[model samples]
Target: MPRASRLAAQLQDEYQAEVSLEKGRGGVFDVWLNDQLVFSKHSVSRFPEDGEIQSAVNAHLAAN
Candidate 1:
């Protein structure tokens, strides 16, 4: 989960918001912001690329 932690730290720094991570087995990956589902690997059938999650976080922040 080191990569995830690093991403979260970067996101937290860029957005200046809290970031929480939940680790699980069997390919259960997801990202959320402001209680909204931003990305879901299970639903999308793929892992997000570098900067994708950050983009989602940015979009959410802009919307808010």
Candidate 2:
């Protein structure tokens, strides 16, 4: 997914957090923060909007 790559890049730049994308069954899109699932596209059936993914990750980071 193009957004996955873009999100990975954005996260690296914005948070300095290393992100790795792995293949899952079908075209499921899952966003994880520290091994915790943040966004599950398979269940939601939609890709996150611009800045949404980063914000979610940042929120989690800020809380920790």
Candidate 3:
């Protein structure tokens, strides 16, 4: 939960993005941007490293 909060803060601060956190079961953790899936812990079987999700969001923002 703390990690999620930090990630939200980082995204909001860095990209001016509106972030929302949804409760999930079974260790689910994902990051989405603009309705696109940026990162998924379930798929990767691990959490994102520090700025991984941020980088993904940045790339998505730049592309679109």
Candidate 4:
């Protein structure tokens, strides 16, 4: 599955505008912020402080 479909619901729960992932030729999971389509291979898989995936979800919400 692509990051967009997987993360869209999570992003929606926290009131993010919109997000989608673009798979590069190398098959990296890039994180996109809004339709402007910024790319990152950082694999936003963990943020340990808050102890729940929703916390990490909310942090990204606050970010954008």
- Highest lDDT among the candidates is held by which one? 3
Report lDDT per candidate.
Answer: 0.85, 0.83, 0.88, 0.48
Q: lDDT tens string, model 2, 1-64?
A: 6778888898889878878998777878889988788888887788788887878787888888
Taking the tens digit of each residue's C-alpha lDDT, what string does model 4 give over 1-64? 5444656666566655454444557545454443332333455543222224445445666888
Cα TM-score per model: 0.81, 0.84, 0.92, 0.38
The CA root-mean-square deviation of candidate 3, after full C-alpha superposition on the true structure, stands at 0.9
Residue-level lDDT for 64 in candidate 2:
88
- Candidate 3 lDDT at 5 equals 86
Colliding pairs, model 4: none
- All predictions: root-mean-square deviation over Cα? 1.4, 1.3, 0.9, 5.5
True-structure lDDT of candidate 3: 0.88
Candidate 2: segments with Cα more than 4 A from true spot: none
Candidate 3 lDDT, 1-64, residue by residue in tens: 8888899999889888788999889888998877889899999999999889878987888999
Name the top TM-score candidate.
3
How many angstroms is residue 50 displaced in model 2 relative to the true structure, after the best TM-score fit? 0.8
- Weakest 10 consecutive residues of candidate 3 by summed lDDT: 53-62
lDDT of 1 at 35: 79
lDDT of 3 at 56: 90
Q: Model 1, 10-36: lDDT tens per residue?
A: 988987878888887998788888779
TM-score of 3: 0.92
lDDT of 4: 0.48
